[model samples]
Target: MNSFSELCSLLNQVSSADYKKILLKEYLDSSTDSDILWALYLLSGRKLRRSFDITGLWEILPKLAGLPEWLIDESYQISSDKAETISLILPVDPDEKRITLSEMIKFADDISELPDSAELEKIINILKSINAEDKLLFLKLITGAFRSGINKKDIAAALSEKYSITIISAFHFLSAADPYEDNPDNLLKYYKRNKKIFSSYPFCSAQNQDTASVFQGDCKQWLAEWKWDGLRVQVIYRKGELLIWSKSGELVTEKFPELFRLSQFLDDGTVIEGEIIAFSKGRPLHFSILQKRLSLKTVPVSLTDDFPAALIAFDILEFNGNDIRSMPLTERRKILASVTEKSADQEIMYLSPLLEFKSWKALAEIKNSAAENNCKGIVLKKKDSAYSGNDWLSLNLEPYIFNAVLLYAQRSLNSEMYSEFTFGAWHNDELITFTKTSGGLNEVDLIEISDFIKANTIEKFGPVRTVKPELVFEIHFEGISESKRHKSGITLRNPRIHRWHKDKKPHEAGYLSNLLELLNAGK
Candidate 1:
């Protein structure tokens, strides 16, 4: 292994993107070509193939550090980071040998192929030559868990600054091919070869606006579309290949095979942004249902029958291999309508309908019907605004009842008083708090719920008892707003328990996105 402890130290010291970029660029300028390639893969969020698993790491750590297994286990429980736990338990090396990034990756690959009898001695020898900090990085790389604060965009920024190219171009270059095998010189060559092709573009987000302020705007210059509850995605079809990118730039094509098959109908070199919704009998289902359909390589026949997938395209970024982001939204919408009607299957792909309104008063009445129509709110986009930089606004119709899971319960300060239940929704696997209320349940209901909570308690933090997420309750809130204090990033206003939804599962609980839509609309 070549000396590469400096890189780990740099990563530990900086948190800002700018500083991280500077350090990366500096290292790339001085490091070997192989080291630069490995750095590019790690900084750009590429997961390298793991040669070993952490299951053996526990057994290996004790022998390497001459420490008891219990000591390492206790440290891991406190830190909750496997890399950090191993690093903390290992002895520090004063005369550590410097290992290059490529050499380290190669060594990990070599270790994975070693027999179980020989692997422990080999791992210990490698650890003995490196300090704790570099050992953590090495272990992380071997385990394919090398996530730092930096992301692909940060690496792109550094590349763009160093090479004097656009950040978007850098993104395209990095995404076009594997960095481990693709040389830096290929960035320009790849860019020139596919300069006309459209890559994923950053989503133009909306600013929150009050209900009255949004309606008072010029109705003639604004275009209204229903804000469907689904995953926002960008679908690009270039040179007979289709790709689906989520809002966060994640490649989610394999997750929705049905959507990928439908995207095959799009014209080559076309890019459209839309929502991937789960629909049944031609009506969109809740976001919870859509969540179940995600992260899947193939949908089962039984599940697909219950929740079919569909795409609702609303905006066009490119047409016929030409960039049209600079075009006025109204004109682009016309072209989009024409193309969708010509090439897309009406049953699978939908062009979002535009609503015509004479005034704010007229629109207000229509928005009130959102709940009945399965619409969360209405998106107001300026007709004359360009697609890339235009500031869109969302107007939420009303706050609807949402199903949340019971997270933790706490009794009121007065012992004779009622118990307050902390309610939260599931964000992926995490249960995040949105509201706490004690007003909805009666004396009998409180006693029943309190007894259930006590029986299912997992842990206690002061006065609060953290219970298992087995109970589902329907909650109603007047409005939603951004709150830094909450884990969900938003809080509900005037939240109260509507009723207990005993039939619902924890995974079916409402998401933070449920409140974010209304909070985003009102902002």
Candidate 2:
């Protein structure tokens, strides 16, 4: 426990990527296999299930520390982190012994199966056995809020360097094998095998580039397709079983049962890369419709009928138990077209249509009409580029912008100062809340806004403060839609603060009717 806690502290203090790799390799070399596996699991941004509710911790802390509840709350307000607050206030024992990371994981797993009272008792005893630093990590683990600066890429790079293998091989191994369940020997075997039934290849992400630069060469060298706004997925069919893996490496086979029919058209050991969209009536619906299908564990027949799911296949990574990622895009596209042609009659699958353009100006004109066709933009891939090559580019539409007045402010969980702000647009005679954003501001702007929030408060509701609507901001968003859930009868997608509108008056802010007009125009 102490060693793991020390490693976490060291990782938090460093910012250099190369230095982080060195630290991870050193720790991996010195730690036991069990400890190494657990470390990778946590450092790669995967968290264990919360064994107990966080509110339970607040109740237990006041009793354990013999401190007033109000004082604890005040400290929490300042630190803005529960683990840090609890670790600071808890009483430390000089004779406490350290436990191994594997032992700590076992304790958490064991207590999750116990009754509420028994779990609480075991938690208290364990908390008392560890020092304050180790307790912070332990509490973070149990609460499922563990975070280290390192990411999956860093871990894979470390392993690649250590074992003298390609980074892609490391990524495939990590994605296929569950660190929590697989032992060191099993992990080695899987790495050696290099391929598994449910394993996903490292996704090839496109680089964002302007139209001029992307099309500077001969336009015929690039193949364009409409960039669909949907969840990126890889559908795998192997050994008569079908599995769906999201871009984040999550297994989501059961979420969209409508996709199960795809197995009939796919051959054994075939893996098709595509977007899972909420498609109906021969057109793609808004992304919010697809979001509704994601949360339910089981899809009812009626729900599936209303918001049917479909795959717009983009490429093929494997064909008939063979990896084809090394093939050029032109060759791979032929193979993909042939495979998807078998499912032409099926509504659940379709090939993402390739766009025809002879010049950059022609492609730009096509991009201008993308939103009306329910596409984000166009994707351009070099005709002869390999799947593993970095030759793909995405040219997206400019985000819609609106001038809105600041209406509310709130302190974020990571900072005591006011960081989150709600903005509103005019609706007839009143300003109605339309969106909120916490990003796109520098340190100076954040401090200035915090001061404004403090001085112009109109009312307070818990952590949120109703602010005087005097400041205006330029808000940018991807899309807008009318919704009954919002008080303003409207919502914006991916809204963020574009800039502080220092020169604009609050009364000059955009009206809700303008946003509604834009929404209707897209439809």
Candidate 3:
């Protein structure tokens, strides 16, 4: 428990990824398998099964420490944390020995089985034996509020380095690790096997091909497909078994049993990459409908009948017991068309449509008009590129750039960093606020903007500073829709500052008419 507490303290101090990895590596080397497994389970954001609920803590803590409600509230307001306040006011006994991690969990379970009076007394006595840090940790564990700033991937990376395994294998192993079912030891065995037969390959990402490059290349050498607004999934059927993995590497087979039912149609040793979308009356439904289905742990028969999940198999990674990732995409598509053709459920499973364009001009027109077909955008892939190749580009038509005026800037809590800025557009002589952007600014730009904001401050209100509406910024966004909550009466999806439009004036910025035109045009 002391070593675990020390590790947690060390993790909180370092901000560097390299330093965090070093600390984790050192801790892993010194700890036993049981201790390391417990640490990893906590680090990966998993908590113990609740043996007791601490819902009454607010009432219990004040009485236990003899602190008034007002003092506790004031401390919480200042510290911005409840756990820290409880730990600070609670009485401590330094002479008592610390309990082991396993003992702590066992103690909580044992106390939970007792009556309320005995349980409360046992908890208070246990808290007295541990330090403030461990007390907070133990309480968080029992209450299921444990969290660390460290990324879960870092834990996998550290373990991979320690065991001399590939990062991907380590990631999959970590995903399957669970302490309650004795899964940590099983994960070590799976790591030893290193089998990726049914494991989904890490998704291949596309780079943004500039307009110049798109025009410079011949259309015949490229393949175009609609970028479906749905979840990307990989379906694997092997050894009379089925598996579905989301792009994030989550096993989602159990969530959609309707798609899992299609496994019988596919042959063994087949793996295909595709999109999971909701369909109704032979048309793809809105992505929001698919999201509703995803949120359900088990899809109801009635909802399944209504939404009817479907998959558009876009690419084939494996076919008939052989890995075909090295094959050219054109060849793979041919194989994919043939394999999916063997399936009986054509309505639930089919190949994605391949757009035919003669020239870049024609493709651009298709891309601009994609919204009419409810398409998000278009993907361009080199015909000769392998299925595993990274030579693919995604271009969206809705997210067109527009010039906007910077209306306000907000300062960061800790530093003088100008973290967020409110942007607005001219709405018939009024500078109405629409969206706030906090990212996509370089350090130099931030400093320049910060200095300009300080020199031109007009008014101050809390963290927000109203500056002279003289700064114009070129904002890039995804789409515009009517929004009553915004002062401009419209919402800009994912607005980000592209660059400082120093050459433009506030009066010359965008207007409500222009935004309405965009909304009407459905661009």
TM-scores, in order shown?
A: 0.63, 0.64, 0.76
What is the Cα-based TM-score of model 2?
Answer: 0.64
lDDT tens string, model 3, 313-398?
A: 98988888788898999899998988778764557688998998888888888887776665678898888898654789887665
The whole-model lDDT of each prediction reads 0.75, 0.83, 0.77
Tens-place lDDT per residue, model 2, 239-282, is 77688878865566777888898898999989999998887687
Ranking by TM-score: 3, 2, 1
Which regions of candidate 1 are displaced past 4 Å?
Answer: 1-5, 54-57, 60-95, 164-180, 198-224, 230-234, 240-258, 287-309, 322-334, 342-348, 354-363, 379-395, 398-523
lDDT of 1 by residue, 1-523 (tens): 2345566567667666678787778887888777776777676656666546667766677887788888888888899998778877877787886677887887887887888777767876787788776788888887777765566667777877887765556665555556457776665666656644535677887665778777674678888888776788988888866777778655566567666665546788788888888888888766656665563435577776678777788999988888899899989999889867864654667899887789898888777877655567778898888885446888875556898988888877656433788888766768888889867777777777888887888999977899888989888875565667677887665688888776788888888777788777654
Error of 1 at 503 (Å): 39
Q: Is candidate 2 or candidate 3 better by lDDT?
A: 2
| C-alpha lDDT (0 to 100) for residue 54 of candidate 3 | 63
Candidate 2 residue runs with Cα over 4 Å from true position: 1-195
Q: What's the C-alpha lDDT at position 57 in model 2?
A: 71
